[model samples]
Target: MDGVTIIDHPLVQHKLTIMRSKDTSTASFRRLLREISTLLCYEVTRDLELTMETIETPLMEIQAPKLEGKKLVFASILRAGNGLLEGMLDLVPSARVAHIGVYRDHETLEAIEYYFKAPEDVVNRLVIVVDPMLATGNSSIASIDKLKERGARNIRFLCLLAAPEGIRNFQEAHPDVPIYTASVDSHLNEKGYIVPGLGDAGDRMYGTK
Candidate 1:
């Protein structure tokens, strides 16, 4: 828990409860995911640097705070990560986007990368990698590995839910990148699914599987 931040806002918790219900419809689940994602995005970027710039008001000139340095890069881990990506973009419209296509091999739970695209200027900009569940940490860790290989120095990981095993694995693999999530569930089931989780986030969101 040393490098994890949980977003416990009332609205976030309320929506997450609904999302956890098996009775929830796909449309409702998708809507709640987008709404909760916006709230989570707010907490993840809370410490962004700020600079002051002079601006003219209707009657006089004033200095206003503005974000400093390059715009943020939201590196989505493909498919399910895009669920969080949509709402994050709603909050930070100017943030750059990166797509890393990686999937878990159901049998081995190993991450396989088939596609990757990111801004050429990822050297100094902050990159936040997103996925709905961190059950095994394989995909998240592999995605960050690709980002770092491309010269990304400052990075963070964001997810809707995380398992203790996944968190420990992620921390051991990439301690430098902090994690943000709405909840750290009890544990992962034998099939690599988060116990009591809202099922497959990607499937629930898109009505797939």
Candidate 2:
């Protein structure tokens, strides 16, 4: 779809296939999740702003560009988001990390925040809210709302996969923030699960079963 980033890297696609297989072992699943996230991290940070400065080479000095500002505050939306967070850290080792835990109300389908914390100067820094699944967007929206309350206007949503309905809902609610996903599949199922999604990101990631 337009305005959506569906990463089509061969490696990502291949790993996703393995992750999707019910026969895959938990160890393999976890490893692939990390690998895919690292790949997506490269794509997600491609547009980050940069400034040029003089640098010294062995022979001489030359102007070069490096990442600027306060680096980034990656606010992981708990358990599942941690999957992507670890990989992101590998790429942005100096980035500040925070946590905000939110859960879904099975009956009401509303997001409930049980925990929230952030960096001291989160607003001035580039912020990224990450979770692997953007199912109904409630959690992402709520997490963003909390971050905004703390003065985080500059933000991005990173998900490994998304459902069209959730994407629409999130875009409508927070039109200002852009979303990044490895893939956006079809509509959600009757029970609200994104069809063909890697089932229950939290459960899958943690081997809760």
Candidate 3:
């Protein structure tokens, strides 16, 4: 809770509810994720520093506030993270994108990274990591670790849903990175699934098992 922000906007809540329903089709779920991500981006970027710039309007010149920092970088955690990435990009088209591919080793339940690619100047940008679900926190933590290894200092984690266990682990692992989610679910089930969550977010969105 210290470094986490739960986005409870009306539109975000409503869309989350629909995503939780078992009857919701894959296409609908994907569409809702994209829509909800736009709202999440709004909150995440609320405190960005702005600078006044002189600009010419039809009749006169005026100073207008504009973002005054390096371009943002959206670091997505593999296939599922892409769902949130697409929508966030819709809102901030200029933001750069980084892809981190990690998966849990079924037996060991350990996160293994197969691929990682980030912007060349990650140190100068605000890196926002996107993932649909924060369950065990293994993948999320590993992704951030990779980003930090690549010179990223300013980072934030964004997800559609989160579990108490996952949040605790993430906060403990990276206290500086703030987390944003639509809902913090009851808890994670035995198999590492968030209880009352929208099933497997990647599977639901992409129709994979």
Q: Return the top candidate by lDDT.
A: 1
In order of appearance, the predictions have TM-scores of: 0.99, 0.95, 0.98
lDDT of 3 by residue, 110-164 (tens): 7999999988999999999999999999999999999999999999999999999
Q: Sort by TM-score, best first.
A: 1, 3, 2
lDDT of 2 by residue, 1-209 (tens): 65677888999888888887777777787888888888988988898888899999999999999887777998999888998898889888999998999998877778999999899888898788899889888999999999999999888888888999999989888988888888888878866787798788778777887
Q: Model 1 lDDT vs. the true structure?
A: 0.94
Better of 1 and 2 by TM-score: 1
Q: Residue 93 of candidate 1: its Cα lDDT?
A: 98
Query: Backbone collision count in every prediction?
Result: 0, 0, 0
- Model 2 stretches astray by more than 4 angstroms: none
- Model 2 TM-score is 0.95
- Candidates' RMSD to native: 0.7, 1.3, 0.8
Q: What are the Cα lDDT values of the candidates?
A: 0.94, 0.87, 0.93
Kindly report which residue pairs in candidate 1 clash with one another: none
